[model samples]
Target: MPEISRFLGMIIAMYYDDHAPPHFHVRYGDREAVIRINDLACIQGNLPPKAMGLVIEWAMAHKEELEKDWALARQDLPLNKIAPLE
Candidate 1:
């Protein structure tokens, strides 16, 4: 997995040639979630309420970049880093 962004103690990453529905992985402390790019919904795992909200907010602001990253990841290409929440 490659990390695309990190902020407020949350780390966002994606795997090369990962599964369908185009999702990214989020890690906050011991918790983790796979959020879908199109819907910004958690498809797997869990995160604390605060962390989850922050993830959603960041995702919403960077949806297009996330989608582009997903495409590059599917092809095993290098991913571009996204700006973290201020």
Candidate 2:
């Protein structure tokens, strides 16, 4: 997995040539989740409430970038780094 953003101890990443539905991986401490890019839904895994909220807020702000990165990742190209939530 390639990390594209990090904030408040949360790490956001995506895998190259990953599975369908366009999503990103988020890791906070030992918890993690796969959030779908389109609707910002947690398709897999789990996170704490505050962490999940921050993830959603950050994802909403960088949804477009996430989509673009997903496309790049599908091609196995280097992904662009997105700004972390302040």
Task: Identify the leading candidate in terms of TM-score.
Answer: 2
lDDT of each: 0.93, 0.95
Query: Lowest summed-lDDT stretch of 10 residues in model 2?
Result: 9-18
**Model 1 lDDT-worst window of ten:** 68-77
lDDT of 1 at 84: 100
> Which digits, one per residue and each the tens of the lDDT, describe model 2 over residues 1-86?
89999999999999997899999999999998999999999999999999999999999999999999999998889999999998
Off by over 4 Å in 1: none
* Per-candidate alpha-carbon RMSD to the true structure: 0.6, 0.6
TM-score of every candidate: 0.97, 0.97
| Per-residue lDDT of candidate 1, residues 31-78 (tens digit) | 989999898889999998988998999999999999999999888889
- Candidate with best lDDT: 2
